[model samples]
Target: MPNTHRLSPVPSTLAVALALALISPLASADDASGTTPKDLDAVVVTASPLKGNTESVATPVDVLYGEDLDKAKAGTLGETVAKLPGVQTTYFGTGVGRPIIRGQEGPRVQVLSGGIGSMDASTVSADHAVSIEPFLADQIEVLKGPATLLFGSGAIGGAVNVVDGRLAESIPDQPLSGRAEVRGNTVNDERTGMFRLDGVNGNWVLHVDGLVRDTDDYDIPGVAILHDHEEGEEHEEAPQPNGTLPNSSVRTKAGAIGATYLGDRGYFGLAGSTYRSNYGIPAGAHVHGEEDHDHDHNGENDHEEHEEGPVRIDMVQNRLDLKAGVYNPASFLESINLRAAWNDYEHVELEGDEIGTRFTNEGYDARLEAVQKTWNGWRGAFGLQFGSTDFSAVGAEAFVPSTVTDTLGLFVLQQKDFGPWKLELGGRYDQVKLKPDDRASTDFSATNLSAAAIWRLSDGFDLRFGLDRSERAPTNEELFAGGTHVATQSIEIGDAALDTEKGVRAEIGAHWHTDRVDLKLAVYQTKFKDFIYLTDTGVEEEGYPVRLWTQDDATFTGAEAEAKIQLADTAAGAWDLRVYGDYVRAKLDGSGLRTVAFDVPHGDHTHGYEVDIAQGGYLPRIAPMRVGADLGWSLGGWRASLGAVRYSKQGDLAQNEEPSAGYTLVDAHVAYRWDRPASSWEVFLDGSNLTDEEARPHTSLLRDYAPLPGRGVAFGIRAYF
Candidate 1:
């Protein structure tokens, strides 16, 4: 169990805005012709698997678009997603990170690509990085709360989907389109280059993309935790550290190709990608703090040098997706569509081929939907989905004798739009069977239901209420995971008879938007009947933390708010400011059940803030709060833009008793674009963390042992043809 600490009132993080106003500089750019409206663009979010307003959906969703990525300065998908309201990052170091959703990690949250399941082994462990690259993505989506209906059994916590590859819709009529960029950063002394190219000829479209990144040991802003060892205290310190990166330095490379044929009826595509990396790892806190202990026992030597090694990971994945729809031509029964996908994934770890392990997973999913035009103001979708997975592992860490699981589900959904009011109802049924290579098979089935409503009181005012019941079956890992988890220094144990987890989630929310201001607020609560978790016994039973996977009944509740304000907008440019935050309280049943595996005790809270400003403000990580401006001018046949992002410190973490400190990161970018003939190119310079301020981010889960690297600089060139 975690050492509990007395609680403190939630800090007043919003007060920082007052201080920012007193320190920021004024915008100098002005409208050249003064004819354009000053209103901000209407931001739309597709959070649900179906189409709906972000504010009115029955489920909670966070949307990150390409523009949002620029403001975040996040190098990877894991880092960018951590800035969401209920999301957090568990960092092994700067190089390795996994998103923790509503306090659930690993398999609980599913990762997808292009609307289909991604079979990567990311869910198998925390130290592994997801293969998707945010830099090459069109958008990143978060399906917060229970998403068991759209995804399969593993989606009780939530889901993340990275939308990349070529889209039949985004393709231009000019036959070819592509973008190329180069960038560099200081923290890890890292450099990256990427290019995306696509071409359309008749009914065929082809796309190819690639990215390469490499860095040396990152430069630490503070003392290094791994180097603080005492030679003569063998019993004091924990086991070996996990990753290879010393400080923040890490390496990554990826490439992908996709092709599609667009016919009169629909479109189908095939895509494949490969990712490789070698990064640093930090020892668990329990292990790091005991390095000074003195022990002389069992005729054993007390002094031994700590061994440091990098964790190596490689992944390859292939997917096929098809979307087909038939239009009614008439208003009634407007359209019927079907979506299907298949994926194959392989992940391996190596300390050299002789050591480590490998896991392979393959899955298939298919969904059919029918949409109807309402005669009396009602329209929605009804669907059915089927999915299954086969998993296996080899080498030292392999779990069971390879297992296979099959699942089938059916769902019905309907939406009614009544002027200012909207209502939706959905229900799902699932049947699953797990077959092990050498054990009796387990079979289970569950049903889930959800209902929600929204009221638009006015042009810019809205209110929403939602409730849902969800269920999730155990994965192969939770039923058979064995051996030691090197980073956590825990001898992991699994429970085969664990029952399915079922829960109720509810939320009430409102949103207000105007030409100059936008605000959103929501209050949510969740109750779980059987929650799977890990419990610590505080004993080194097998040379590590004697921890076992368990389950219990629990309750959780929280509230969240997000807002953005338009400070200025003119024909020349515009600037804006934004902020967001959330707080949650979770507790187990009245039994006072000391601890259950993987469970966080009650009264835990998390919150964050962002400030941003620009002709077009951007916040990638936490939807930054900015106080800056943009300037644009035309010189000859070229247009130039200059902008700056003054990012505030990342927010505090709920899981940590003593949270890390926030820092100020200042970045500047200048770009010049050329307009000549049918081709154009852009050249720009970007400097991040310009002030060299020390900041610890949630993405750096190993902050106590590894601080982020300081200042960074990068130059890049982009072109479109």
Candidate 2:
């Protein structure tokens, strides 16, 4: 058993009080001045190659920046964006999480840093954390649907881009400008601080940013395990006491520095960053048996014994990025933009104080895009992208073999406007080579095509349709892994013969906008020729269940809808009501032809029953349907919101899978800002799981072992100059 001690909440209470004190005066000032808040439209950069706003994009996009981002930021990327429609988080304890978009995760959804691949091993495993930190980001963009034309084969499902101004593309208006923030949370006794500084001297722009965060084990509402009993059932072990979860602490530090030379025609910049983290993995899951030992004649142990302790991960990453852009050139291309990044990442998994496994990845990605002036009423951009990675894992838990992968891709995007309609077309071709140190090399080539149209039916309504055929090559982990994954408590086996996955996606959506109302509804379906997924094998290896990476013809269908209504605009505030919902259903068509065995009877008309090998099964770990609503009020420099999200019970299950009960989580936030002549300061309070609901995300394999954090309040303050 693990320790059950809890941290005092005195600091949390003080932080909350400080925030309220800062906000009360602001609210009073707003009332005396009788000022009203202004609503501003948001701009998104990941939707397309060209600049576009959320309302103008052909597909759904969510952008978080400024005060909104600070209020919503969490320890992990998944939790930061979990409230968005069609998005769910796969929580691996409190230390690691990645977003699950539209029922797709792993390699299908790409996590990017400034429009390029993050070059991290997050996709290789669920317990791996994304390299980017939300605190240091200037903006985070979530682009829904197929984005292969823009990002590459890895973005067959969607893409999330974290934009940090480390490599400054443009110089700031002021010579020196920066921002700083401090935050504290009660649930985990977490404390965080971050700052960014930018200075310009003689056309040379310099940037520096740093962040530090530390947290203890998080508190929970109830016992770690729940037991159900009937009138005639045997009783098991009693439930553990409600307290903090053991081995759930986290500590992280990151920093970056960069410089840019800004000329009249173009700008070029380079940046280098380093990140370090040490986090404890949640305990209470499966534990392997101790190694065998031979006793001596005197009853002494023959082998050394290692102390048992919580599992943890110590990770470090060093990265460098180069960015350049030219406003105009004398060649055929009107302008050009270049971006490249090189990353060195490594992490060690420690059991107690002993290292169990170490993972390393060294990779580089480069892309060059050229824009052309309007030619024959069409505007477009063409780009070439290349990337290579060498990855290895060594130790007792080395599940996958060392591998090297190289990829090159070329893509073009064009758009034309005719009357009240706009048409966009794009195509990409990628060639990938994967070589395992101990296995035969495999080569894959894929061609992806996309088309979209937006037609204006009236002044405030638009209809959009999109079609895409995207292809993705299998990853090394999916093709070569064969070992136990301790975090998930499962034995994983991979199939080397799996083919590339190809998907055809069709989407139709409608957007309506008015001074008082904004609405969007989209429906989409994707059909795959070879959909790769992990399936339970109903077998056990070393006391752990087995999961095999397999491929099958599958289909995924989903819908998303959101509406925002402006109810009132008064001196007290601008009140708005918003409602959003999303759902996805994925199923395998049928079981392919495979060999099977059955019992035989002698001299009987019916010898035995035929068994169907794993066919017509639902996809595992898909997020349950969700519906949510929120009310917002903003006046002057103060803002407040109250919301609730209701997740439907997930009864649909694959073979040997269990169902998860439905849950509703309530959340609220309040913020106030104070503006000065040359600077601004803001304080906010955020509350989550106010009802203390026992919620478990169905998208996570650790749902049975770890539940979501309960009844937490956070206080934060930010300053900009």
The candidate maximizing TM-score is 2
What would the TM-scores of all predictions be? 0.79, 0.88
Misplaced by over 4 Å in model 2 are 1-42, 226-241, 289-307, 591-593, 596-612
Identify the candidate with maximal lDDT. 2
The residue pairs that clash in candidate 2, if any, are: none
Q: Model 2 Cα displacement at 211 (Å)?
A: 0.7
lDDT of each: 0.60, 0.80
State model 1's lDDT: 0.60
Q: Kindly list the per-residue Cα lDDT of model 1 for residues 1-721, writing each as its tens digit.
A: 2323123113212323432242222211222232332343433444344565555564667777643554443655667786566676666666566665665567778887766666666766656667666777767778777777677667877888777754444456678777777776555666888888888877878889888888777655544564444355334444443322243456777777777776675556666666666554433322311223323233223323322244455566666666666667346776676667777777676543333677788888777767676657666666677777788878755644478888888877777777788888878888888887868888878788888788888666678888889898877667776555554556666777889888898888776655555566667778888777655544453244545666677666656565555565666556555555554445555442243333211124311212111111111122112233333344443443344333333332221123345455555655667756877777766665666655555334355566555566666676767
lDDT of 2 at 200: 93
Query: When superposed on Cα atoms, how far off is each prediction in RMSD?
Result: 9.0, 9.7
Cα lDDT tens digits for candidate 2, 1-721: 1111122123223433443353345434544565443343757574366767776666568888876687678888888887777888888878888988998998899988888788878888778888888889898899888778888898999988888888776779999999999999999999999999999998899999999999999887776544222246553433563677778899999999999988899889999999888888776553442211122123223223433577888999999999888977746667898889999999998888789889999999998999888889988899999999999999977778999999999999998888889888889999989999999999999899999889998666689999999999999998988776766667777878889899999998877665566666777889998899887766543345667787889988887777777778998889988878787888888865443333221223323323335866678888878878899999999999999999987765777778889999999999899999999999989999999988888887667667888899999898999
